[model samples]
Every structure is written in structure tokens, then in C-alpha cells.
Target chain A: MIENLRDAVVDLVYLVCAVVIILGLKRLSSPRTARSGNKLVAAGLLVAVGVTLLDPHIHWRPANIAVMLIGTVVGAAGSIYLARVVPMTAMPQMVALFNGMGGATAALVAVAEFQRFVASGAVTAGERVSVAFGTTVGSVAFTGSVIAFLKLQELMTGRPVRFPLQIPLNVAVVAGIVAMWAWLLGFAGSSASVWIMFGLALLFGILLVLPVGGADMPVVISVLNSMTGLAAAAAGFVLENQILVVAGALVGASGSLLTILMSRAMNRSLANVLFGAYRTRAAG
Target chain B: MNQEFLLGLYVLILTIFLGFEVISRVPTLLHTPLMSGTNAIHGIVLLGGILVAGTAENPLTLLLGFLGCLFGAGNLFGGIVVTDRMLEMFKKKEPAARQA
Candidate 1:
């Protein structure tokens, strides 16, 4: 009886959280209400996390509880401190840094899930695909955002970094990732293959963002943001979580739309922002 | 292909359209906040981290989960707090202060 009740409560809470998230997004449409909207969304997330702690699936062992407590406290306190202290001039890098952490988290979650699937030795093609997609996309977003942070922070040259045959190199890296994806799903399905794919994806991300000039950081950040959301959604599929699916898709859509809008504001297209890297330098 | 996936698909598709509708109206001035807000939202992956970490059976997965939790928390809190700071800038009104 308690199990059934718990299941029902979980379902109900997830549904409510989804609605609250959507409402929060809606409220963000206007600046006057955006702060409150942010507050509502934060509250909703808090409830979601609290409820997740009660999930029957969680082992709640001392080690597990320790990990959760220590991780959350340190992470939250560090971010809050940085957020409060960072000057307005550094906002772009700040966003990029935080977004990178989110992407890395998504990728790690997918990696953990893949490990579980491998240990069980009963993986399905669909599960493999989701895990592969999440890991690759998340890894790309992670590294890409970090590079963007570096460029924005002026820790590296903000000018577009280009090398001989950069386009071909990137294309080759992408093709390799696709091949690995197929191998993981079709034959090998090993954790080692996943790591290799993860590494390649990271390389691709660096290549993807490295050639863009500093002036175009907004578009680069937007694209990486969308990629992170898509990755989170893929992680959702890997874990079969409805809230992840809904929240991830919502973020993915927002980032994609913002990317388009920002690019349009610059009188450029999405493809141009992403792939037209160094074209101006070459043409000039 | 399964029922769960199909349902997730439906939800995903609907949210995508809803995302477009909701964000289409935000002014350019607030784009940064919007981006950061959504960034914070995706930190929902922290839940995934917690779930995996709570059930991890091996050292690697445990480490991954722990990192996930740490990073996810950073994303969640940092994104929100930063976006709020940005929004607070717009909230300050000069005329009221001048009158005072």
C-alpha cells in the first residue's frame, strides 16, 4: 500500500513541478516579472530535489548521503559566492562557466548510466543510443563552454583561433564520433568506446568554438547552451525521467530560439554563426 | 518506442513549441537573464547526479555522481544568482531616487 501511495505521490509531484517550471518560463517573458519567475522556478527545483531524496530507488547509505550533502553544500556555496562577487563586466564568462558545469554534470550522468547498463549486460539499442547521444553532446557542450569562458575571460586570445585545414580536421573528428556511436550501439557496447567517443566529442567542441571571434560570443554561448539542453534531454531518456524530459526540452527550445534571435539581430544566420567562423578573416 | 519514451516524446515536442511561444516576446534587453535562467533550469541534472550517486556500486560511478552533484549545484545556484543580479540592475529606477 505504501509503495502504491509513494508512486502516486511521485507522479503528482512531477506533474506539478512540470507545470511550475512552465509557468516560471512564461513569467520570464517579461523583465518586470522575471525575478519572481526565477524565484518560483528555484522553489520548484528545491521541491523536486527534496522529493527525489525520498525516492525508494535511492539506497541512502551513509556514503551516499555523505556524497550528496558534501557535494551540494560545496557546490551551492561556491556558486553563490561567485555570483555575488563577480562584477558586471565579467557576466559573459560567468554565465559560460556555470553553463559549462551544467553540461559536464549532464555528461557525467550519462556516463554513469552507461556504466550501469554495461554492468547489467542487458542493454538495448535504444538505451545505448540515448546514453551515447547524451555523453557526446554533453561532452561537447562542456568543453566548448569552457573554451568560451577562457576566451571571454581574456585568458586566451579572443580573436578567432584558426589553423591550417581546420574545417577538414573538424569534419574528420565528427565522422569519427559518428562511427564510434554506431560501434557502441551495434557491436562493442563497451564503456571504453563511450570514453573514446566522449574524448572525440570534447575535441570537436574545442574545434567548433575555437574559430569564432570574441564579438560572436553570444551566439557561441547560445548554441552551446542549446546543446547542453539537448544533452540533458538525452540524459532524461537514459533515465526515463519525465521532469528531465520536459525541463530539458524547454531549455533546449529557449536556447535555440535565443540563438536564432541573436544571430538575426546581427544580420546573420545560425549556420553562419556556427560554421562561418573565420570567413570574414579569410575574405578580408 | 516504448510507452514511456513516446510519452516523453510528446512532452518534449510540446515543450519545444511552448518554449518558442513563451520566449518570443522577451525583449532584447533581458536576453542575458533568459539565457542564464534556462541555464539554471537545466541544472536539473543535479537530480540525475543525486540519483546515480545514491545508487552507485563502483568507485568511478560514485566519483562521476559526486562531480555531477557538485557541478550541477554550481550551475543551478550560480545561474540563478547571477541572473538575479542582472535583473536587479534593470529594476533600479533613477527618477524615484532623484525625487528623494
Candidate 2:
């Protein structure tokens, strides 16, 4: 009876968080309530994390606890410092960098889960698919956001970077990635295949963002932001966590809408923004 | 599919629609803040990191979990702070406050 009660309480808490998050996002639509809305969402997230710590399955390893504490403190403090110091002109870059962090987190979780599967030697097909989906999408979002950050920060040329037969090269990379994915799932089933696929996906992410002009960064960032959300959702599937899926899917929806709006503002189609196929104006 | 997976699918589908319906109503002027705000939401992956790290037994898995937590915290906290700062600019500042 106690066990069942505990489970019911946990499920109820997750459902409440989900509802709060949705209402918070709703409040963000207007400027008047935006700040408070953001805070409300943050509060919801804090409660979710608190409850997760109390989950029965968590191991109480001293080293693991120490690492989490230290990492979180330093990371949070550093991020606040960065946020305070960045100029308003650099806001887009800041968004891209932070979005990259989310993607990196998802990728790390997926990779760690994969390692666990390898260690246990008793993996199911569904688990394999979830892990693969998480890793590939997370890796792409991570590198893609980083490249967008670099472009926006003026560390690299923001012009459409087209070399000889760039389209063909990208096609070849995609084909290679698909083959590796099949190999990992079907025949090889080895750790080496996983790492190789990760590397290729990272490369593909860079290639995907490099060709878009800097002016299209808002669209790029939105797409990457959405990709990160999808990756987080995949992590949810891997972990079988309901709240993660709810939060991730919400972000995915928000980002997709923003991407469409941004593309419309630029008078470009989403495909044009993504594919670099649009005509460029002569330098004024 | 199993019951759990089916339940998860339902949750996912509902949230997606809920997200679209809410966000599409936001004005264009607030898109940047909206992006950053949603960016913070995805930081829920921090929970996943904590779970993985807490359960990890080996050094490699622990390292991955540590990095995940670090990055997730950065995203979670940084995103909110940045968005708040951006929205701060949109606030109506009093001329008297500036004079003081």
C-alpha cells in the first residue's frame, strides 16, 4: 500500500508540473506577464528536479553526488555571469550557445545510457532505437548550435560558404550516416559503430549550418533550438521519464513556430532559409 | 506498443499541440525572448542527467553524467537569466527613475 501511494504521489506531481509549464508558456505570449511567466516555469522545473532526487531508484554514491553538486554550482554561476556581461547586440549568440548546452546535455545522457546497455549485455530493440535517435539528434543539435553561435559571434564568415559540389558532399555524408545507422542496428552492434556515427553526425551538423548566411541566423537558431528539444524528448524515451517528454515537446512546438515566423519576417521560405538555395543580393 | 509507451505517446502528442496553440499567439516582437524562454524549458534534460549520474557505477558513465549536468545547468540557468535580461529592456522605465 505504501509503495502504491508513493507511485501515485509521484505521478500526480509530474502531472502538476506539466500543467504549470503549459500555463507558464501561455503567459509568455505577452510582454506584461513574460517575466513572471518565466519564473513560474523555472519554479515548476525546480520542483521536478527536487522530486527526481527522491526517486527510489537513485543510487546514493558519494562520488556521483559530489560531482553533480560541484558541476551544477559552477555551471549555474558561470552561466549567470555570462548572461549579465553579454551585450544586447550579442543576444542571439547567447541564445545559440545556451541552446547548444541543452543539446550537449541530451547527447551526454544518451551516450551514457548506451554505455550502460553495453555493460549489461541485455539490450532490447526499442531501447536501441531510442538511444540511437537521442544520440544522433543530440549530436547534430550540439554542433549545429555551436556553429550558429560562431557565425553570429563574428568568429567565422557569415556568408553562405559554398565550395565545389557542396551539395553532393552533403548528400554523401548523409548516405554514410544512414549506412552506419543500419550497420549499428543490424550487423555490427558494436560500440565502435556508435562512436563513428556520433562523429559523422557532428560533422553533418557543422556542414548543415555553415552554408547559411549570417542574416538567416534567427531561423538557424530556431531550427537548432527545436532540434535540441526533440533530442531531449528522445532522452525522455530512453529514460522513460514523463516530465522530460512534456517539457521537451513543449519547447519543440515553441521553437518550430518561432522558426516559421522568422522565415516569414525575412520573406523567405523555410526551405530557402535552410538549404541556402536563395539568390543573394549584390554587395551594397 | 506497451502501455507505458502508449501513455508516453499520448503525453507527447498533447504537449505538442498545447505548445503550438500557446506560442502561435505570441507577437513577433517577443520572438527572441520566446526562443530563449523555450530554450530554458528544454533544460529539463538536467533531470535526465541527474538520474543517469546518480545510477552510474563506472568512471566513464559518471564523467558523461557530470558533463551532462554541467551543460544542463548552464542551459537551464543561463537561458532564464538571459531571457529575463532581454525582457528587462522591454519594460517601461520611468523618466524620474532615470533622473534619480
Candidate 3:
């Protein structure tokens, strides 16, 4: 009975958090309510985190607790410092870096799970697929987001970096990675191959995002956000965590929608985001 | 101690924060763009959903993953559309100002 009550309480908290997120998003749609929206989001996140920690299933291992603490400190410090110091022109880059961090965290989580499976000899087919997808998608998001950050910050050139054989090179890399992933799926104990595939995907992501110009930062950011969601969902699958799965899915769907919307805002198509079709003369 | 208490606490805290936000008023310039930008961030949910959907063994999980993807896509697209309209209005004003 106690367990049931606890479960019910947790569910209620989750529902409340979800409502907060929705309300926050709505309020944030206009300048008049943006501040309130931000506050609502912060409150929602706090509630969600608190509830998660209270759950019995979440064993507060010393290492896990320590990691969470470190993450919180770093994240808080970074956000505070950036908000105070970053120029308006560089806001886009800051966003990219933060988004990249999320993707990297998800990727690392997926990689850790893969290591656990290898160490314990408890690998399952489903687990392998999840890890494989997570690693590739997460790596892609991480690298792509970093490149975007660099581009936005002008650390890298904003102009599309296209070579004579760039398209073919990109296609080849993608094909190779896909083939390797397929092989990894079929072969049970190919850890090295799996890592290699992830590396390739990372490279592909960089290559893919690098050729895009600054005018497309909005679209790039949106697309990368979607990638991060997908990465999180993949991580959820690897861990078999229901909350992670749901949260990840929500992020992914929302990110994709945002990406599409961003494209339309610029009078560009999704195809343009994929193929580097749009060109701004001023960018040159 | 109970869900009600927790919920009440949340509401109280939220109210305080909202009040402060309204007073500061610095984030006004950022309202529309930030909303559109952050909404795009939510699109990450789709990526997560896709990953989840691919790996989920159970039917329930798969369903949730799909839903996540759907909602995320909607947000992404909707945000962009709104932003586009806002930009168009700005562009129109530029031309009108030139004529004046």
C-alpha cells in the first residue's frame, strides 16, 4: 500500500511538472510573459528532479550522487557566467554550445551502458541496437553542435566550406558508417567496430553541418536540438528507463517541429537545410 | 508530506518567480525570438523519441516514443512558422519607412 501511494505521488508530480513545462512554453511565446515562462520552467525542472531523486528505484549511489552534484555546479556556474558576459551577437553560439553539452551527455551515457553490457556479458539484442543508435546519433549531435557553435562564434568561417568532392565524400562516409552499424548488429561482440562507427558518425555530423552558413543558425540549432532528443531517446532505450524515454521523445518531437518552423521562417524548405541550397549574397 | 502539499508549494514558488519576472522586464526584447528558439530546442525530443522507438522492445514504450516524436515535430514546425511571420512583418515595416 505504501509503495502504491508512493507511485501515485510520483506520477502526480510528473504530471505537474509536465503542466509547468507546457505553461512555461506558452507564456514564453510572447515577450510580456517570457520571464514568467522561464520561472515556470525552472520550477518544473526542480520539481521533476526532486521527484526523481525521491523515487525508491533510483539508488543514490555515492558515485551517481557525486556526478549529479558536479553536473549541477558546472551547469549553474556556466549559465550564470555566460548570461552576464556573453554579447547579444554571440547568443546563438552560446545556445549551440549548451545544446552540444546535452548531446554529449546523452552520448556518454549510452557509451557507458555499452561498456556495462560488455563487462557483465549481459548484452541483449535490443540493448545492442539501442546503444548503437544512441552512440551514433549522440556523437553526431555533439560534433555537429560544436561545429555550429564555432560557426556562430566566428571561430570558424561562417561561409559554407564546400570542396570539389565534398558531396561524394559525405555520402561515402555515411554509407560506410551505416554498413558498419549493420555489421555490428549482426555480430554480437564487436565493440571496436561499434566505436569506429560512432567515430565515423561524428565526422559525418561535422561535415554535414560545416558547409552551412551563418544565416542558417536558427535552422541548424533546431535540427541539432532534434538530434539531441533522438540521442536521449536512444539512451532511454539502452537503459530501459521509462521516464528517460518519455522525456526524450518529447524533446525530439518538439525539436523537429521547431526545425521545420525555423526553415519556413526563412522562406526555406527542409530540403534546403539538408542540401545547402539557400545562399545569402551578403554572407559572401 | 503529500501531493497536495507539494503542489501547493510549487504554485507558491511559481507565483513568486512570475512576479519577479514581470517586474524586471529585461527579457522583453527576447520574448518572441527566445520562444521560437527554445521551442526548437524541444525538437531534441524527437531525436530522443526516434532513438527510443528504435530500441524499445515493449509496445507501450514504442508508442510513447512515437508520440514524443510527433509532438516535437509539431513544436519545431510551429515555432518556425510564427517566427517567419514575425520576420515578414518587420520586413514590411522597413519598406514602409523608406516610402515615408
Candidate 4:
């Protein structure tokens, strides 16, 4: 009875977090309520995380806690400084980098989950498909966002990094990704294959984003955000976790809308944003 | 096909519409801040990172989990903070400054 009650409480808490998150997103539509909405979303995350820490299945130890604590501190302090110190002109780059972090997390989870499967001998075909897909998308978001960040920061040129072979190279990388996906789904893929997929996807992300100039960055970042959300959603499918699914879906939805709105605001089409490198006049 | 997968699909379909409806009305001036805000929402994937990290035993798995937690935390903190900062600037209507 106690065990069932505890499980019920956990599930209920996750639902609460999910609802609060939705409310937060609803409030975020207007500028006036946006900060408070952020607070609400943060509150929901806090609750969800607090509850997760109490789960019996998690093997918490001092070392693990230490790792988490250090990460939290660095992330929190670094952002607090970014908010305070970084000028307004650089906001988009900061956003891109932060979005990349989310993608990296999803990719990391996919890898970790696969390692677990390898260890336990419980690997299933569907599970492999989801992991392979999630990790590829996640890797794309990670590397692509980094490239976006570099350009926005002026660490790299904001102009299209065009070369004669750019299109064909990108096509080949993408074809490689598709082939690897098939291999994984066919149950013939090994860990080596998964890593290869990850590398190729990252390369594909770079190739895709490299040719777009700075003027297209807002739309590019927003699209990447949607990709990260989809990767997270794929990760949820891999894990079969309800809260992960809900959270991922919420991000995916909002990110896609934002991408559309950003492109419209720039008066560019999706195809233009993706491939219109010949139009140098579009650079801001 | 499976029940859970179908349920997830249902959730996904509903949320996509919900997102479109909620975001369509936001003004252009607020677009940047709003994008930053949604960026924060996705940071909830940090929960997955924490879970994976906590359960990890092998060296590679542990390293991956640690990096995931780091990245996820960075996303959550940095995204919200930057959005709040951007929103703060938006609230300050300058009397004579040019657009951002």
C-alpha cells in the first residue's frame, strides 16, 4: 500500500510540473508576464527535480552528488554573469549557446542509455532505433548551435562559409546519416556505428548552418531549438518516460512556432533560410 | 501502434496546436525575448541528465552523464537568465533611442 501510494504521488507530481510548464508557456506570450512565467517554469522544474532525487531506483552517492553540484554551480554562475555582463546586442548568441546545451544533454542521455543496454543485454530493435535517431538529432543540434554561436560572437565570420564543394559534401554527409539510421534499425549497427552516425550528423549540422549568414541567425537558432526539442522527444520515446515526453513535446511545439515567426519577421521562406546563400544582400 | 506510443503521439499533436495558438499573438518586438523564454523551457531535459547520471556506473557512461548534466544545467540557467535580461531591456521604453 505504501509503495503504491508513493508511486501515485510521484506520478501526480510529474503531472503538476507538466501543467505548470504549460501555464508558464501560455503566460510567456505577452512581454509583461514573461519573467514571471519563467519563474513558474523554473518552479515546475525544481519540483520535478526534487522528486526525481527521491526516486528509489537512482543510485545516488556522494561522488554523483558532487558532480551534479559542480555542474549546477558552473551553469548557474556562468549564466548569471551572462545576464548581467553580456550586452544586449549579443543576446542571440547567448541564446544559441544555451539551446546547444539542451541538445548536448539529449545526445548524452542517448549515449548513456545505449551503454546501459549494452551492459544489461536487454537491447531491443525499437530501442536501438530511438537511441540512434535521438543521438543523431541531438548531435546535430549540439554542433550546429556551436557553429551558430561562433558566428554570432564574431569568433567566426558571419558571412556564408561557402566553398565549391559545400553542397555535395553536405549531401554526402546526410546520405551517410540516413544509411546509418537504416543500419541501426536493421539491428546490424554496433556502438561503432552509432558513433559514426553521431560524427556524420554533427558534420551535417555544420554544413547545413555554415552557409547561412548572420541575418538568418535568428531563424537558424530557432530551427535548431526545434530540433533539440525533437531530439528530446525522441529521447523520451527511448526511455518511455511520460514527463520527458510532455516536456519535450512542449518545447518542440513552442520552438517550431518561434521558428516560423522568426522567419516571417525576417520576411524569408523556410527554404530561403536553409539554402539561399547566393542572396548576400540578406546579411544584416 | 503501441498504447504508450499512441498516447505520446496524442500529447505531441495537442501540444503542437497549443503552442501555435499561444505564440501567434506575440508582437515582433517581443519575439527575441519570447524565443529565449521557450529556450529555457526545453532545459527541462536536465532531469533526464540527472537521472542518467545518477544511475551510471561505467566510466564512459559516467562521463557522458556528467557532461549531460553540465550541459543541461547550463541550458536551464543560461536560457532563463538571458531571457529575463532581454525582457528587462524590452520593458524599458527609451524616450529617444533607436531600435535594437
Worst 10 residues of 4 chain B by lDDT: B91-100
What is candidate 3's lDDT per residue for B23-90, written digit by digit as tens?
A: 23223344335534443433333333333334433444344334433433333333333333443444
| lDDT by residue for model 4 (A1-284), tens | 77677767877898999899888877878767877887888788778767867655567687777676676667667766775688889989999998988998888888788877777886776578778868998889899999999999999999988887766788799889988888877756777778888889888888888988887889999999988888887787776666777777777888888888878887889889988884654473
Evaluate every candidate with DockQ and list the scores. 0.79, 0.76, 0.06, 0.63
**lDDT (CA) for every model shown?**
0.86, 0.85, 0.58, 0.81
Supply the global lDDT for candidate 2.
Answer: 0.85
- In candidate 3, position A198 carries an lDDT of 72
Model 4: how far residue A26 lies from native, Å:
0.8
Docking class of 4: medium
**Candidate 1, B30-90: lDDT as tens digits:** 7888898888888888888888888888788889989989998998889889888877777
Any residue pairs clashing in model 1, and if so which? none
For model 1, residues A1-284, the per-residue Cα lDDT tens digits are: 88678867976898799889889888877977988898888877777777877777788788888888789889999999999998988988888998898888889999899999888888877788888989999999999999999999999999888888887898899999998898898896588889989899989889989988888898889888888888888888888888888888989998999988888889988888776766766787
Quick one: best DockQ, which candidate? 1
lDDT per residue as tens, model 2, A82-123: 989989999999999999999989888888888887888866
Candidate 1 docks at the CAPRI level of: medium
Compute the lDDT of residue A282 as modeled in candidate 3.
26
Between prediction 1 and prediction 3, the one with superior DockQ is: 1
How many steric overlaps are in each model, in order? 0, 0, 33, 0
Compare candidates 1 and 4 on TM-score and give the better one.
Answer: 1
Best by TM-score: 1
Q: State the TM-score for model 3.
A: 0.69
Which interface RMSD does candidate 3 score? 13.1
lDDT of 3 by residue, A95-183 (tens): 56656655665665565556557766767767777778778887787788889889888888988777667768888999988887777
